[model samples]
Target: GAGVSQSPSNKVTEKGKDVELRCDPISGHTALYWYRQSLGQGLEFLIYFQGNSAPDKSGLPSDRFSAERTGGSVSTLTIQRTQQEDSAVYLCASSLGVRNSPLHFGNGTRLTVT
Candidate 1:
Protein backbone atom coordinates (compact mmCIF):
# COMPACT_ATOMS: atom_id res chain seq x y z
CA GLY A 1 0.00 0.00 0.00
CA ALA A 2 1.20 3.52 -0.72
CA GLY A 3 0.01 4.69 2.68
CA VAL A 4 -0.38 3.13 6.09
CA SER A 5 -3.33 0.83 6.66
CA GLN A 6 -5.12 -0.03 9.88
CA SER A 7 -7.66 -2.70 10.67
CA PRO A 8 -11.24 -2.47 11.92
CA SER A 9 -11.89 1.10 10.99
CA ASN A 10 -14.34 1.17 13.89
CA LYS A 11 -14.73 -1.17 16.83
CA VAL A 12 -17.35 -1.43 19.53
CA THR A 13 -16.61 -3.60 22.50
CA GLU A 14 -18.18 -4.04 25.88
CA LYS A 15 -16.61 -2.42 28.86
CA GLY A 16 -13.72 -4.42 30.28
CA LYS A 17 -13.20 -6.26 27.03
CA ASP A 18 -9.83 -6.26 25.35
CA VAL A 19 -9.13 -4.89 21.91
CA GLU A 20 -6.29 -5.05 19.44
CA LEU A 21 -5.59 -2.63 16.65
CA ARG A 22 -3.14 -3.18 13.85
CA CYS A 23 -1.15 -0.89 11.63
CA ASP A 24 0.86 -1.52 8.48
CA PRO A 25 3.35 1.15 7.66
CA ILE A 26 4.76 2.12 4.34
CA SER A 27 7.18 -0.43 2.93
CA GLY A 28 10.82 -0.02 3.98
CA HIS A 29 10.05 2.57 6.61
CA THR A 30 11.99 1.80 9.77
CA ALA A 31 10.22 4.11 12.16
CA LEU A 32 6.73 3.69 13.53
CA TYR A 33 4.64 5.31 16.25
CA TRP A 34 1.30 4.69 17.94
CA TYR A 35 -0.85 7.35 19.47
CA ARG A 36 -4.29 7.84 20.93
CA GLN A 37 -6.57 10.77 20.36
CA SER A 38 -9.46 11.16 22.73
CA LEU A 39 -12.37 13.05 21.34
CA GLY A 40 -11.65 16.77 21.21
CA GLN A 41 -8.06 16.22 22.26
CA GLY A 42 -4.73 16.26 20.50
CA LEU A 43 -2.78 13.17 19.58
CA GLU A 44 -0.86 11.70 22.46
CA PHE A 45 2.16 9.61 21.58
CA LEU A 46 2.14 6.15 23.05
CA ILE A 47 5.07 4.15 21.71
CA TYR A 48 7.70 4.36 19.03
CA PHE A 49 10.02 1.99 17.22
CA GLN A 50 13.04 2.44 15.02
CA GLY A 51 14.17 -0.31 12.78
CA ASN A 52 13.13 -3.50 14.57
CA SER A 53 13.76 -2.10 18.03
CA ALA A 54 11.81 0.16 20.30
CA PRO A 55 13.85 2.75 22.12
CA ASP A 56 10.79 4.39 23.61
CA LYS A 57 7.75 2.81 25.14
CA SER A 58 7.26 5.31 27.89
CA GLY A 59 4.01 6.80 26.74
CA LEU A 60 1.84 3.73 27.16
CA PRO A 61 -0.87 4.79 29.60
CA SER A 62 -0.59 1.70 31.72
CA ASP A 63 0.44 -1.91 31.76
CA ARG A 64 -2.90 -2.57 30.11
CA PHE A 65 -1.75 -0.83 26.98
CA SER A 66 1.10 -2.29 24.96
CA ALA A 67 2.41 -2.33 21.44
CA GLU A 68 5.03 -4.00 19.32
CA ARG A 69 6.46 -3.43 15.86
CA THR A 70 7.51 -6.40 13.85
CA GLY A 71 9.96 -6.47 10.92
CA GLY A 72 10.13 -2.70 11.45
CA SER A 73 7.01 -2.02 9.48
CA VAL A 74 3.94 -3.51 11.09
CA SER A 75 2.61 -2.69 14.54
CA THR A 76 -0.11 -3.81 16.89
CA LEU A 77 -1.57 -2.02 19.89
CA THR A 78 -3.36 -4.08 22.45
CA ILE A 79 -5.61 -2.59 25.05
CA GLN A 80 -6.44 -4.86 27.93
CA ARG A 81 -9.49 -4.47 30.15
CA THR A 82 -10.84 -1.73 28.03
CA GLN A 83 -12.91 1.03 29.60
CA GLN A 84 -15.27 3.61 28.22
CA GLU A 85 -12.48 6.10 28.66
CA ASP A 86 -10.37 4.00 26.35
CA SER A 87 -12.82 4.69 23.58
CA ALA A 88 -10.71 6.79 21.30
CA VAL A 89 -9.00 6.71 17.97
CA TYR A 90 -5.85 4.65 17.93
CA LEU A 91 -3.57 6.13 15.34
CA CYS A 92 -0.42 4.81 13.71
CA ALA A 93 2.26 6.87 12.11
CA SER A 94 5.48 6.17 10.24
CA SER A 95 8.32 8.31 9.05
CA LEU A 96 11.80 8.15 7.64
CA GLY A 97 14.50 7.76 10.24
CA VAL A 98 14.81 11.39 11.20
CA ARG A 99 13.53 13.70 13.91
CA ASN A 100 12.35 16.28 11.42
CA SER A 101 9.94 14.34 9.29
CA PRO A 102 6.21 14.59 9.00
CA LEU A 103 4.38 11.53 10.27
CA HIS A 104 2.10 9.80 7.81
CA PHE A 105 -0.97 8.40 9.54
CA GLY A 106 -3.30 5.54 8.89
CA ASN A 107 -6.98 6.28 9.15
CA GLY A 108 -7.05 5.27 12.79
CA THR A 109 -9.03 2.46 14.34
CA ARG A 110 -11.78 4.00 16.39
CA LEU A 111 -12.35 1.90 19.47
CA THR A 112 -15.57 2.40 21.36
CA VAL A 113 -15.91 0.51 24.58
CA THR A 114 -19.42 0.78 25.85
Candidate 2:
Protein backbone atom coordinates (compact mmCIF):
# COMPACT_ATOMS: atom_id res chain seq x y z
CA GLY A 1 0.00 0.00 0.00
CA ALA A 2 1.17 3.55 -0.70
CA GLY A 3 0.34 4.51 2.85
CA VAL A 4 -0.58 2.74 6.04
CA SER A 5 -3.63 0.52 5.71
CA GLN A 6 -5.95 -0.63 8.49
CA SER A 7 -8.69 -3.21 8.24
CA PRO A 8 -12.32 -3.25 9.31
CA SER A 9 -12.41 0.54 9.17
CA ASN A 10 -15.24 0.40 11.62
CA LYS A 11 -15.88 -2.22 14.29
CA VAL A 12 -18.93 -2.51 16.49
CA THR A 13 -18.38 -5.20 19.07
CA GLU A 14 -20.65 -6.11 21.88
CA LYS A 15 -19.51 -5.49 25.39
CA GLY A 16 -17.21 -8.23 26.75
CA LYS A 17 -16.42 -9.47 23.27
CA ASP A 18 -12.98 -9.60 21.71
CA VAL A 19 -11.86 -7.80 18.59
CA GLU A 20 -8.76 -7.80 16.50
CA LEU A 21 -7.58 -4.90 14.33
CA ARG A 22 -4.98 -5.22 11.65
CA CYS A 23 -2.49 -2.85 10.07
CA ASP A 24 -0.14 -2.99 7.12
CA PRO A 25 2.66 -0.49 7.10
CA ILE A 26 4.31 1.09 4.12
CA SER A 27 6.90 -0.93 2.31
CA GLY A 28 10.57 -0.25 3.10
CA HIS A 29 9.65 1.55 6.25
CA THR A 30 11.34 0.26 9.40
CA ALA A 31 9.06 1.84 11.97
CA LEU A 32 5.41 1.20 12.74
CA TYR A 33 3.31 2.76 15.43
CA TRP A 34 -0.15 2.18 16.81
CA TYR A 35 -2.10 4.94 18.42
CA ARG A 36 -5.65 5.58 19.48
CA GLN A 37 -7.76 8.73 19.53
CA SER A 38 -10.99 8.54 21.42
CA LEU A 39 -13.83 10.99 21.33
CA GLY A 40 -12.62 14.34 22.61
CA GLN A 41 -9.32 12.77 23.53
CA GLY A 42 -5.80 13.33 22.34
CA LEU A 43 -3.79 10.87 20.31
CA GLU A 44 -2.43 8.24 22.61
CA PHE A 45 0.53 6.10 21.67
CA LEU A 46 -0.17 2.39 21.96
CA ILE A 47 2.95 0.73 20.66
CA TYR A 48 5.91 0.92 18.30
CA PHE A 49 7.87 -1.75 16.46
CA GLN A 50 11.17 -1.27 14.72
CA GLY A 51 13.31 -3.64 12.68
CA ASN A 52 12.69 -7.02 14.39
CA SER A 53 13.75 -5.92 17.82
CA ALA A 54 11.28 -6.12 20.69
CA PRO A 55 8.21 -3.96 20.19
CA ASP A 56 7.62 -1.02 22.47
CA LYS A 57 4.33 -2.15 23.96
CA SER A 58 4.39 0.19 26.89
CA GLY A 59 1.46 2.23 25.76
CA LEU A 60 -1.10 -0.54 25.95
CA PRO A 61 -3.79 0.56 28.36
CA SER A 62 -4.20 -2.73 30.14
CA ASP A 63 -3.43 -6.42 30.20
CA ARG A 64 -6.41 -7.09 27.96
CA PHE A 65 -4.72 -5.29 25.08
CA SER A 66 -1.92 -6.92 23.15
CA ALA A 67 -0.29 -6.58 19.73
CA GLU A 68 2.33 -8.11 17.53
CA ARG A 69 4.14 -7.46 14.28
CA THR A 70 4.99 -10.27 11.95
CA GLY A 71 7.69 -10.21 9.23
CA GLY A 72 8.30 -6.68 10.38
CA SER A 73 5.53 -5.49 8.10
CA VAL A 74 2.06 -6.48 9.21
CA SER A 75 0.75 -5.87 12.69
CA THR A 76 -2.34 -6.82 14.61
CA LEU A 77 -3.82 -5.48 17.79
CA THR A 78 -6.11 -7.56 19.94
CA ILE A 79 -8.47 -6.25 22.53
CA GLN A 80 -9.81 -8.85 24.87
CA ARG A 81 -12.94 -8.52 26.99
CA THR A 82 -13.86 -5.32 25.22
CA GLN A 83 -15.68 -2.68 27.13
CA GLN A 84 -17.62 0.41 26.14
CA GLU A 85 -14.78 2.50 27.44
CA ASP A 86 -12.55 0.96 24.80
CA SER A 87 -14.45 2.50 21.93
CA ALA A 88 -12.13 4.70 19.93
CA VAL A 89 -10.44 5.22 16.60
CA TYR A 90 -7.44 2.95 16.27
CA LEU A 91 -4.86 4.57 14.01
CA CYS A 92 -1.83 3.00 12.46
CA ALA A 93 1.18 4.95 11.33
CA SER A 94 4.50 4.22 9.70
CA SER A 95 7.68 6.15 9.02
CA LEU A 96 11.33 5.87 8.21
CA GLY A 97 13.63 5.36 11.16
CA VAL A 98 15.44 8.58 10.46
CA ARG A 99 15.40 11.11 13.23
CA ASN A 100 12.43 13.44 13.29
CA SER A 101 10.74 11.63 10.46
CA PRO A 102 7.00 12.20 10.18
CA LEU A 103 4.41 9.45 10.25
CA HIS A 104 1.94 8.47 7.56
CA PHE A 105 -1.42 7.53 9.06
CA GLY A 106 -4.19 5.28 7.84
CA ASN A 107 -7.84 6.37 7.73
CA GLY A 108 -8.11 4.35 10.93
CA THR A 109 -10.38 1.64 12.28
CA ARG A 110 -13.13 3.21 14.30
CA LEU A 111 -14.15 0.65 16.91
CA THR A 112 -17.43 1.35 18.59
CA VAL A 113 -18.39 -0.76 21.57
CA THR A 114 -22.10 -1.29 22.00
Candidate 3:
Protein backbone atom coordinates (compact mmCIF):
# COMPACT_ATOMS: atom_id res chain seq x y z
CA GLY A 1 0.00 0.00 0.00
CA ALA A 2 1.15 3.54 -0.71
CA GLY A 3 0.10 4.75 2.67
CA VAL A 4 -0.89 3.42 6.05
CA SER A 5 -3.53 0.71 5.76
CA GLN A 6 -6.04 -0.40 8.32
CA SER A 7 -8.30 -3.41 8.10
CA PRO A 8 -12.06 -3.63 8.55
CA SER A 9 -12.98 -0.02 7.80
CA ASN A 10 -15.87 -0.53 10.14
CA LYS A 11 -16.54 -2.90 13.01
CA VAL A 12 -19.52 -3.34 15.29
CA THR A 13 -19.33 -5.51 18.37
CA GLU A 14 -21.55 -6.14 21.33
CA LYS A 15 -20.62 -5.06 24.77
CA GLY A 16 -18.13 -7.39 26.42
CA LYS A 17 -16.90 -8.66 23.09
CA ASP A 18 -13.34 -8.49 21.92
CA VAL A 19 -12.09 -6.73 18.81
CA GLU A 20 -8.81 -6.64 16.99
CA LEU A 21 -7.73 -3.87 14.63
CA ARG A 22 -4.85 -4.17 12.24
CA CYS A 23 -2.53 -1.60 10.72
CA ASP A 24 0.08 -1.91 7.99
CA PRO A 25 2.34 1.07 7.73
CA ILE A 26 3.95 2.36 4.60
CA SER A 27 7.02 0.41 3.58
CA GLY A 28 10.20 1.53 5.31
CA HIS A 29 8.44 3.76 7.81
CA THR A 30 9.69 3.03 11.28
CA ALA A 31 7.22 4.87 13.44
CA LEU A 32 3.68 3.69 14.07
CA TYR A 33 0.99 5.23 16.24
CA TRP A 34 -2.53 4.39 17.30
CA TYR A 35 -5.10 7.02 18.09
CA ARG A 36 -8.79 7.16 18.89
CA GLN A 37 -11.32 9.84 18.04
CA SER A 38 -14.64 9.80 19.78
CA LEU A 39 -17.68 11.75 18.68
CA GLY A 40 -17.04 15.47 18.76
CA GLN A 41 -13.67 14.93 20.38
CA GLY A 42 -10.08 15.31 19.31
CA LEU A 43 -7.77 12.46 18.52
CA GLU A 44 -6.44 10.70 21.58
CA PHE A 45 -3.07 9.04 21.34
CA LEU A 46 -3.26 5.39 22.31
CA ILE A 47 0.19 3.99 21.68
CA TYR A 48 3.38 4.55 19.70
CA PHE A 49 6.16 2.36 18.36
CA GLN A 50 9.50 3.57 17.04
CA GLY A 51 11.98 1.23 15.51
CA ASN A 52 13.20 -1.41 18.02
CA SER A 53 12.68 0.76 21.06
CA ALA A 54 10.13 -0.08 23.71
CA PRO A 55 6.65 1.01 22.73
CA ASP A 56 5.15 3.99 24.49
CA LYS A 57 1.81 2.83 25.85
CA SER A 58 1.19 5.52 28.40
CA GLY A 59 -1.85 6.78 26.52
CA LEU A 60 -3.73 3.51 26.55
CA PRO A 61 -6.87 3.84 28.63
CA SER A 62 -6.74 0.54 30.46
CA ASP A 63 -5.45 -3.02 30.54
CA ARG A 64 -8.29 -4.03 28.25
CA PHE A 65 -6.58 -2.18 25.44
CA SER A 66 -3.30 -3.50 24.12
CA ALA A 67 -1.24 -3.32 20.92
CA GLU A 68 1.83 -4.93 19.40
CA ARG A 69 3.96 -4.32 16.35
CA THR A 70 5.67 -7.18 14.54
CA GLY A 71 8.86 -6.73 12.49
CA GLY A 72 8.43 -2.98 12.81
CA SER A 73 5.80 -2.95 10.13
CA VAL A 74 2.43 -4.45 10.92
CA SER A 75 0.60 -3.73 14.16
CA THR A 76 -2.50 -4.92 15.94
CA LEU A 77 -4.63 -3.35 18.60
CA THR A 78 -6.82 -5.57 20.73
CA ILE A 79 -9.70 -4.31 22.78
CA GLN A 80 -11.27 -6.68 25.29
CA ARG A 81 -14.59 -6.32 27.09
CA THR A 82 -15.81 -3.54 24.90
CA GLN A 83 -18.16 -0.92 26.18
CA GLN A 84 -20.37 1.67 24.51
CA GLU A 85 -17.88 4.26 25.53
CA ASP A 86 -15.33 2.48 23.43
CA SER A 87 -17.21 3.35 20.27
CA ALA A 88 -14.86 5.54 18.28
CA VAL A 89 -12.74 5.77 15.19
CA TYR A 90 -9.43 4.03 15.70
CA LEU A 91 -6.75 5.59 13.54
CA CYS A 92 -3.31 4.41 12.57
CA ALA A 93 -0.45 6.62 11.45
CA SER A 94 3.12 6.07 10.39
CA SER A 95 6.16 8.22 9.90
CA LEU A 96 9.89 8.00 9.27
CA GLY A 97 10.72 8.09 12.98
CA VAL A 98 12.76 11.20 12.49
CA ARG A 99 12.45 14.51 14.21
CA ASN A 100 9.54 16.45 12.68
CA SER A 101 8.65 13.81 10.13
CA PRO A 102 5.07 14.18 8.94
CA LEU A 103 2.62 11.40 9.71
CA HIS A 104 0.65 9.48 7.15
CA PHE A 105 -2.70 8.24 8.40
CA GLY A 106 -5.04 5.45 7.42
CA ASN A 107 -8.77 5.64 6.90
CA GLY A 108 -9.47 4.59 10.45
CA THR A 109 -11.59 1.70 11.63
CA ARG A 110 -14.87 2.85 13.02
CA LEU A 111 -15.75 0.71 16.05
CA THR A 112 -19.26 0.68 17.39
CA VAL A 113 -19.66 -1.09 20.69
CA THR A 114 -23.26 -1.82 21.44
Provide the TM-score for each candidate, comma-separated: 0.93, 0.96, 0.98
State candidate 1's TM-score. Answer: 0.93
| lDDT for each residue of candidate 3 in 5-114, tens digit (9 for 90 to 100) | 99999999999999999999999999999999998989999999999999999999999999999998999999999999999999999999999999999999999998
Q: How many backbone clashes does candidate 2 have?
A: 0
Best by lDDT: 3
Candidates arranged by lDDT, highest first: 3, 2, 1
Q: Which stretches of candidate 3 lie over 4 Å from their true place?
A: none
> Candidate 1 residues 1-114, lDDT tens each?
599899989999999998889999988777888989997889999998898554598898899998877666678899999988898999998888677888899999989999
Please list the Cα RMSD from the true structure of every candidate, rounded to 1 decimal place.
Answer: 1.3, 0.9, 0.8
**At residue 62, what lDDT does model 2 achieve?**
99
Model 2, residue 29: C-alpha shift (Å): 0.9
Overall lDDT per candidate, in order of appearance: 0.88, 0.94, 0.97
